[model samples]
Target: MVERDRLIAALEDATHASSIHNSQPWRFRLVEGGVAVHLDPTVTPRTVDPVGRWALASIGAVVANLELALTSRTGRAVVTEITLGDSIPEAADLAGGAAYGEGPLAVITLGEAAETTTAMTAARLHGAIKERHTTRGPLLGGPPTEEEWAELQAAVAWAPGIQATPASEPLVRSLLSLTARAEDARQEDEDYLEEIQNWVENEAPSGTGIPRGAIGAPDAEGHVPIRDFTQTPMGSSGDGEAVFFEDPPALLVLHAASDTPVDQLRAGYAMQRAMLEATALGLGIGVLGQALEEPDSRAAVDGAAEESFGAPVVVHQILRLGHPAGTITYAATPRRPVTDLILD
Candidate 1:
């Protein structure tokens, strides 16, 4: 197989990467000389990511993983471009062609992998892409070392749309508080809660939605703070369990300059880069959007009006960094089959 083909095969293995409801809301198009990706509107999660921004971000992260795998395996890559749009479902003339539906997120021209053959390093990192899982189990230990924190910050440079800020103790605490508040706000509304409940109950056969086991045990208080994937009767149901993660030593919140779909995708791309880098350093990372998932929390975190900096923090994903208690196995989350996603 060619490099791109090999990379596509690697996607099958990079299953541990995060996606919206595990919808895998992306489609790949093989061109004569390059590849294209499209969002399958039908596959999107209505309740969790209504606007599809989160799903697009997740797809972008998948794209980043694929690039890393290709570079490691072939020592070179040439992306040229990444087009994004609600329409323009397939190929288009980028040079002209009405700029091809608003605009694309990016067009990465793959380059020769470092001649020094970081292949060993890249291979290990790439392998971790599949091994990495967002564990919600209680964190047993503290944050990574100062040196380790620096490494993760450096990894953020590789992400396209993310500006990662290390959270202070106050900031971290504030986010947790915000999370609790968001959970409360969500539960208070019957319509919203019911919608979330429906999503959790359905098990998408194609491996395109969140699996029941992926949620770990539920909250002992009878609530799933995140998406509440178990709200219905679709899978093997179970009771809640006590889980907690103490004040994480280090917290990184990924932000995008804009909230557009394309920008969201870039943010996702950045997330994967940071994630694999953290994995390579033997750090455990978890992505949480509780604070950014709801409007009130979003306003609190955005801080756009305060203008601490000229830019606002969109808070695409929140990553908690620390050491793992032990190896944790995740269920096989489904994905829409490649055949179902391919465009002629």
Candidate 2:
């Protein structure tokens, strides 16, 4: 029972470590030797993530963090075989150095917990895993403190292929402008608009998808920049319109060279890791994948980011990183019960 409680706590820590549309999409079950993590395919935001790639990617982030937290505790994580029975299993007897299998679906075997895993270490990071949330509000004036930024950069060091950098002033302007342009362009596509609207409106208060209060009405004055899923009538007034900040102090972009599911998963993991590192440093990070998700917008954003960063932009997600104007509150995103997601 104690072991079950430990695994449950670890599962919550890892899932909370992931980033979605503030939509947490992971569930876990305590098995004989370990826990199995399954995706709530039914709850996925198909409108925003048509292929379930982002959802899987989010799960991958949870997997990575879970593995890290588990291993960091015991120095080794162990189990039996990875059973890909509908849902992905988190524990298995697989080696740490092995790569994921090539397929739309795969499972991983976690080794035994190493002796290095201590109560203190796990407790310290435990708080970080549970408390982290993405901040989408605006930046104020300057960049984050040198120390904080350095710490963030260091946290993602495990993710070798992904690159993270703070957006410069000119870079920020160009990215925001590009994002806005992308939104305008998306308005031209009725299907895309409908899809996005469905995701925005259908979300339960704590379930998947972006919430109405988090997104402001497009025509409202000083609207905090967010994806306009509503495609509302041009002049319609709604709660979607609210100004949180005039200009954000910093923006962070995560990019990789490869576009494989594995790489996307890696990027998601790195993004979450960096976000938690930022939270630990008293900084807020918000994801803005609107432009990155659209084809034309993707090209523009990629080209501009590539030019600025001096690297080809395989941009997976865009994040706003800065301090919030005041204490921000967030609701707990819902998760399916483990019994529902895991197969026997």
Give TM per candidate.
0.80, 0.76
Mark the regions of model 2 whose C-alpha exceeds 4 Å error after superposition.
Answer: 17-19, 22-40, 68-123, 139-142, 200-207, 211-213, 216-224, 229-237, 244-248
For candidate 1, give the lDDT: 0.61
Estimate the TM-score for candidate 2.
0.76
lDDT of each: 0.61, 0.59
Residues 40-131, model 1: lDDT tens digits: 55555555554455766766777776666666666665454656743432343221122222323444444654555455656777777776
Residue 339 accuracy (lDDT) in model 2: 37
